[model samples]
Each structure stands twice: as structure tokens, then as C-alpha cells.
Target: QMATETRTHGDYTVGWICASSIERRAAMAMLDELHEPLPTPEYDRNIYTLGSIGKHNVVIACPPMGTAAPYIISMTNIFRAINFSLLVGVGSGIPPDVRLGDVVVGTLEGHNPKEMMLNPLVEAENSVHVETWAATPPQPLLEALKKIKTEYELSGSRIPEYLERLKRDSPALASRYLKSDSLQDLLFDADYGHVTPDFANLSFIPREENDCRFCDKTMTVKRKPREMRVHYGLIASADREIKSAPLRDRLCRNFGGKVLCIDMDIARIKILFPSHYPCLVVRGICDYADSHKNMEWRDHAAIMAAAYAKDLLHEQDLQILEWLTPVDYGPRHRDFLRRWQPETGLWLLDSAEYKTWLSTKKQTLFCPGDIGSGKTILTSAVINDVKTRFQINPVVGIAYIYCDHRHKETQQIDELIASILKQLTQKLFSLPDCIRQMYEKHKYGQTRPSLNEILGVLHTIIGEYSRVFIIVDALDECPTSSGCRQTFLKELSNLQNQFGVNCFATSRLDPDIIAQFRTNSISLEIRENAKDVQLYVKRYMEQLPAFTELDQWQQETMLVKVLEHVDKRYDLA
Candidate 1:
């Protein structure tokens, strides 16, 4: 005991409560060697040592073996009651990959049954339906373990949790090392060897060292300084042990590309906090399931891993890496508002049109009126609102697309046709049935369309149920070939009869354009000369402080005159 006491230790003591008396004694001996004591209490069979790690103090306790479920439940239930960081699991390892002397770290868990059984977070383009599962590891902690493993030799073990069990109630649940290939043969009929669907399917990305914003190019990395370093990686927590290729293949593929480590319970952890918490999985590879298996790395692996964790905690470089604490894992819950990346053409939209879009789902109805009217802006606003407002089965996007004609004048019937068709081809991902049928029948780009030919094409493209609103401004500014203006009128008439989409256009009120849609359409001419002139005058006067642009009496006179002019003609909205 005196020799043990002479061994210097951290201010805190650590040990598993499920560890037997002999294991506990070794734990105490280690603590004594480090100048720490095993104050982990013996309550029931659970072990907890009371001590200090830095300024914070708590009993580092362990529940029954393979008992993280109970241990975590109890730990969290009293999380407000305890001062420790977490309930870290310590267990056996599969030899060589995780030999008797090697130290290993357990960070993540895979609870497969819960994931495969639940139909959550399913949407288009994972491209197909794949089984789901939960993955967990607090990322920061898992990353710390990885850096530690690199400088020090480590070992891994499957069912190290079972080792905890052998210490307690059952000797039947084997804690011995077993290769993944031989894992099934070893535990074929062994007690509690059932495979629990693992939380292996979730998409987990690890923290990269050099995260640069300017490029998607791979980063060159180097270590920086920090304190309390945490390790992260892929973590799997399965109920029944998994040793098959299908399961291994899925995990191997994800981990091969992902910052792979192991952890347990992201889904449950996500549920634990309704807010956004990125999933991090880090686990010790317990066995060399691959052809090259080693059998000497187990016991010391965890200890070595723990040493790295300690080194990181004390290292001067800890603070430099603090920025890794926050990562933007876009909305995990479907009910929450989704954010759109700029590249996806979904930037942001907040407008009245957004409100109308959600409540009515109305696609057509252009913001009619002349130039400077907020038509496109209003459309963008509506699409943005749709992103936030509809929580369940959310609308993909409110597409705000515009066509800039090369002609630069008014929208011609042919130019308009060309622009609309181009937008459809460029933007819409799927070809509608009518469009597909029409394309199969006609050869495209043979030549530009005549006015009547354009109308025939428009009818096929814009079908019923889903209406695409066309906003064409300045019809009067449009230059036409000869007297095609009359023919343009005929095309407009055909659009309404066949497609039934509402058309919103602005123009100089040419007698021909007006007369064309004169039937079965709504039109009102804007007296731009009236409101714009008054607005310009009012805005100029308001720019001066204390009505200083003009005398207070003069301001009153001007304000009244502007109000009268504004209220007299035209509608705004």
C-alpha cells in the first residue's frame, strides 16, 4: 500500500465499478503509484473512486460489465448531480489487434435495432432506401484518442463490455479476444451473443485539421497547440455482435472515407437534446479481422490511449484547437427549419409571395405592373418562407428563376419562347410527360420558332396541375419582325386556352398587346408618371433632418401634395 501510495497520480482517480476486487486492487495500486487513491465507492457491486481531476471532483464510477446502458442512464439521471465529464467505459480487447497489455479507448456506440426499426430522416437521394442506425461518440473526445493512438501502440477488443460482466454476475458471457472472422465461431451459441442492429449506417464526418473556406481541395495538415484534447472517429454499438461482410462492408466503406472511429448512440443522443448536436463516433478496433491479425496489443491499449488523453489535457497546444467545438451539421430533425447552401440555388427567401406560396401553394399569378415593381423579389421571398414554414414533409425549394434575353429590349414572342424553354431545360431536373412526348415528336434547335409555332411548343411544356409563372416586362419595348405584333397577340391567346397559366407582364400599354389578352385575362395600366414622381420628391425632402430640406410649412404642403398624388391613381402591393 505504501509503495502504491508513493506512485504519483493525477489529482483524479479512475476505475470501473464492475471490476472485481483483484482488478479494483490493481486500480488502487495504479492510483497509489500516481499519488491518487481509489475512493471509488463500493455500492452494491458498482465501483466509484472519489478524487479530484484538476479543480472538478467526482467519483469516477463504473457499473456492471457491458453495462454502459445502465451506467449511462444512471450517470445522466444524476448528471446534474455529478461533476465529471462523462461515464467512460473501460473493458477487455481482442488480442494483438487488442492484446492483454495494450490500452484501448471506447468512444462511440452502435445501437442497430433502434436505427433499422425506425423510419426517420428518409428523403430523396441517399438515392435508395438503406437501413438506418444510430452512431455516437462525442467527436472532440474521439479525436483526442486518435492522436494519442498514433504515437503509442494500441490494442482493440470486441465485447470488452462482456469482460465487465465476467467480473460481476456472469462468467458465461466471454470477454476473451476473438477475431471478427472467428467471432461467430467463438460465440456461436454463447450466452448473450445475439446481434443487435448497429447504428452503423448514419453519415458521420470527422473533424479535419486544416479547414479552409476558399477551396474544396484536400488540406495539408500539421498539429497546433491546445488543452484537454479530445479524440473522435467512427463508433459502432450493436446489440448482437456483427461479423458479416454486408455489415462490415457498409461500416468499412463509411469509415474508409469518413474520419473513422467508433462510438455509440447518436440517434438517442440526438433525442436527448432536441437541438443540433453533431454525431461523433470513436471506438477501439478490438480485433484484426483482416488477414494480418496480431494478439499482443490488448491490456495496455486502453492505458496508452488514456495516457494520450491525459497528455492532450495537459499539452500547451490545447487552446489553439478550440475552434473545433462547433460544426454546422445541417438540420438533423425533419421538423426543424432547413438551411440551403448557395450552390443548391436555395439561398434565402422572405416575402409576401412566400406566405402566399405556403398557404395557397399557388404557382401562377405574376406581379403585374410596369418596371421597378417588386415581382422577382417578391417571388424569391415566398420560396424562402416555404423552407422555414412547412416543417413536415417540407417543400424541396421555391425556385426563383429568371430569363435575361440577349435582345435586351421588350420580351418578344419568339425571344420569350426561347428564354422560357431554355430556363426549363437548364433548371428543371426532370422532364415532364408532355415535354418528353413533345421532344420525342419534334427535333429541337432546327430553327427559331414562328409566333404560332412558339405557342404550340408552350402548350406542350406548361401542363396542368403544375403551372410555371412567366413574368415578362416591357412588352411595348419589344422589337418585332414586321407586323408580327398582331401574330404575338394570337400566341398569347393560345397560351391561356391550352396551358391555363396566369401571365404577368409589364409594358408601355401598346394597343396591340393589350387587345391580344383583352379576353379572359386581367389587366390594369400603371400611371408610372404619377406615383414615381411623387415618391422621388417625398424621398428627397425626407432625407433632410428636421424637415430642413424645406421649411416646416413647406414640408407640410409638399407632403400633402405627394399624398394626394399617390392616393389618387394606381394600386401598390
Candidate 2:
């Protein structure tokens, strides 16, 4: 049974890019739950399937043009929240190591940085129009790749199991997606050309049969039957298909014999998208890049790649909720993060002061803004950015607090300090001895630890990590009536001064809060940028009841008028 949920565009985190309907269908089959389609912009020509594979909300898109243009349009229009992308499909395999139906993930074997780039193929004195270099994929995906590969080494592949499940669920596609017989999986020698039997007569122009039935079976190369497996190495991609064996060999030689598979059109992604757009290519070998290639294994190959991707996502899902702590700000953090507009608040990330704060130890950054200045949303962006950057590093800890006046009673100084300890300990396998001892010391008496005791335990936990980031949003909301705010700020300063912890805080221009950081911290005033203001106004206008009734000019005029009013009042610069 397929469960359907209503989700917004920002909810999706993974972009599964496909070139053909077969690959699209393969991607859809792997979804655990299908989400209701959200409205897209008129300019985006690509169609998307929104669904979830494990914990990941994956947006699978098949471009109309099968090029980079449509994919870029779609990203700009609909996939604003996509963290990274995966290019999944079937491709022609490089021989000697890879066989038909085996999966190839685009990653270097070891630490060789040279494999990061693939030189363009020169055929007939012309260079192929494709991306010459590719950036590294996101760290989480790389970590998942390592985990899945380790699992494969220990227990073989789970791809066969997923394929069997798909066959059981979709009867119509079962026949097409079924594995081809080993006998039909044929490879011809590179020098052996598929030519007409009547070679003596020039009248014979081409081979007749699509299959190799009419060709000389004796020319087929013999290979031992092996289980379908996954390979990891460099992938060579081009603008066009490689149907010629000599061209494929030349391309492989150009890459120093490191090309594991050759795929068409994937290069467009790297060529068009920036390096920050993280992507990983996963290809299933459909045929050896030779004249004997046919559609016999393409369907099987597509499903094989899709099955591996699903398993990879399943592994990724496991890592997300592997730990639970007593106090978790994850819910609050997620709520604030959901309000973030894509591509907004990037100026703060690019600012020199913010960079210095991140690069230096024991640094504090204070951001003060007026009310309705999108301070909370920008803070959420910073938290999300920092977490994404250091997600794969076990020695880094991120703890955040979303202070609210309504919850001030529960968000006292001791509780707030302990929350940091709670979050950081979740990153470790077990609690530090001091924390466990403190808990035991107070458990029987139902007594709460003092602020200093909690801070002492926090100090112990902070030492476990190479670096720790403390982010507090809406710090002005921390209750000042009972001295909670002052105590909390003092504890944060003590941690930064004593333990080299990095602290990031956002509050209104409260004189007391500003006084604490004015001397020793990098301070930045949070102001709404013109672009972000325009985006916010446009999104709000789109939700109005009369928005659709207006013509294009009128709608644009309304947007311009609203932005002008905002600029006049706030001086968005």
C-alpha cells in the first residue's frame, strides 16, 4: 500500500535526476510513500514525482529536454530545498572489470584526488561537449556509501531482494525488469565488428538482426559467471552515446584506464550546476560500449541501479534516529528551519565576520535585529548550514536552543545548560562518566542539579569534542525577570572562555544583551536584504485569494509596489 501525504516544496531534501521514463519509473518504484504533487512554476518543463524512501523525501524529476537546461530550470523553480542530487540510470559499461547489470557508483577507490576530474573525449579531432570536472558529493552521502559498501562486503548485496519486492508489487513491469539470462549477456572482442556475412559484396551495407543471433557466436568472449555486484570508481560521461568500441577505448585510456562506465548526458549536470550543487552519479551497466549493444539489458540495468539507490537511502535513514536524548531541541529547530526561504540569508554565510567566527575557536558572534527582521529564520539557516558542513565529523558537536517567552518557566538556566549537554552526549556512544554520576546522584532524591553542577558536567562533555557550537535563537525571549537570561549568558561566556566553544546568538537590540558581546565578539546587525524581501512578499502574495485573478502585469506590479513599501520602511540593502 502506498501512503500519500501533503508536503510543501521545502520538505524535499533529495533530488533524483533521471533521463528516461524507465529510469523515472525505477525511481518511483523505490519510494516508500508517495506525496501529493505540489504546484510548480510555469517555466519549469520537467515533471516530478514526490515521494519518500525511508526518511528522505525524494523529488524524482525527468527533464523534457534530457539536458542540463531543463534540470536547471526545475531546480530553480521547484527543488529549492534539495540538499543534493543523485543521477540514477543505465549506462554502457567499460569492460574487463564491470559486467552487464552490475552497479557503478561514481567515487574514487581511495584518496586519489586526480579522479575528481575526467578529461573530455577527443573523437575525430573534436572534443566532446561535456563537463571536464566534478565536485565531491555531500559528506552524508559519502558516509552512507561507506556504510552500504561495508554491509555489502559482509552480507553481499540487498539489491536482489529489493528487485524481487518490486516484481511482486508491480506485475506489469516484472517482465521488463526481470534479469536477463546469462547466455544473452554477450560481449564481443573490441576488434570484432558486427558486419554483414556477405563481406565480399559491397551491396551488404549493415547487419540485419537487432540481437546477436545472426552474428558469429564464436566471436563472443567467454567470461565466468559471477554474482551481480556493485563497483565504485570514476565515471566517464559525455554529450552523446558511445556506440563505437574504439571511441570508448580511447576515452578510457584518456582517463588513465579509470573510467568504470560511460553514460550519456550526465556531463550536462556538472557543466551547468555549480560545484556547491552536490551530486553523485549511479549507473548500472547495460552493455559494453560496442556495436553489439542492445536494449536487452537496459531495463534490468535501470532497476539494478534503482535498487541500490533505495538501499543506500535505507542505510541513510538508519543513521538519523539512532540516538535519543533526554532533552531534544530537534523539534523546535525543525519548526524554525521549515520557515527558511531557500537561497535567502546567504549574505550572512558569505560575510567575513561569520567566516572568522566559524574558523576561530572560542569566538562569539552576536546578531541583533529589530522585530520582524527574519532573525529566527536566519539563525535556523546558520544552524542548518553548520550541521550540513560537519555532519560526517564525529568530533564536532552542535547544540541549539530556541528561546520562547511562553516557555520561559521550563527554559530555566539549569535546564537550558543541561540541554546542551543532552544534545552533545547524543553524538557519543555512551554518556560521559561525570554526566552519569551526576544523574545518579540526583535521581533518588528527585532533586534538580544546580546551574554550576550542570555547567561542570557540560564542561566534561565539551572536552570530548574537538569543537562545539552553541546557537541560541531569540535570546531576548529568555526571561530576564528572574535573572535567567543573565545566568545563561554568563554560562555561555564561561564555556567559550574556558573550553574554546563557539557561541552564536541572535536577539533584539536589548541593551543588556548587546553589552555582553560588544567587547569581545564579532557583531553583525541582521537586516532583511532586498532580494529576500522581494521573495517573501512574492510568496505571500501568491497565497492571497485574488492572486490568480490578476493578470501577469498586475501581479508583477503588485509585487513591485509591496517591495517598494517594504524598502521605504526598512531600507532593505
The best candidate by TM-score is 2
Per-candidate clash tally: 90, 0
Give the per-residue lDDT of model 1 (tens digit) for 1-573.
122332222333222232223233322222212234433224444545544222223344455563443453444343334322432323222221232223333333342322332122235213212222333334554564454454233212112222332233323222222122332111121121223223322345222211122222222222232211223322334333333323333544544433232223333334453322222222233332221222233322333333233343222122221211111111111111132112221211223442343344223333334454433333333334443343112112211223233443424455555445543332222233344344334435433335455455455555422544444444555555654445554554555456544445545445666665565554443433443445545655587686675677899786887677554322222
User: Which residue pairs of candidate 2 clash?
Assistant: none
Per-candidate local distance difference test: 0.35, 0.77
Off by over 4 Å in 1: 1-412, 424-457, 512-514, 528-533, 541-573
**Residue 461 lDDT (model 1):** 52
Candidate 2 Cα errors over 4 Å, as ranges: 110-132, 196-209, 320-573
TM-scores of the models, in the given order?
0.28, 0.53
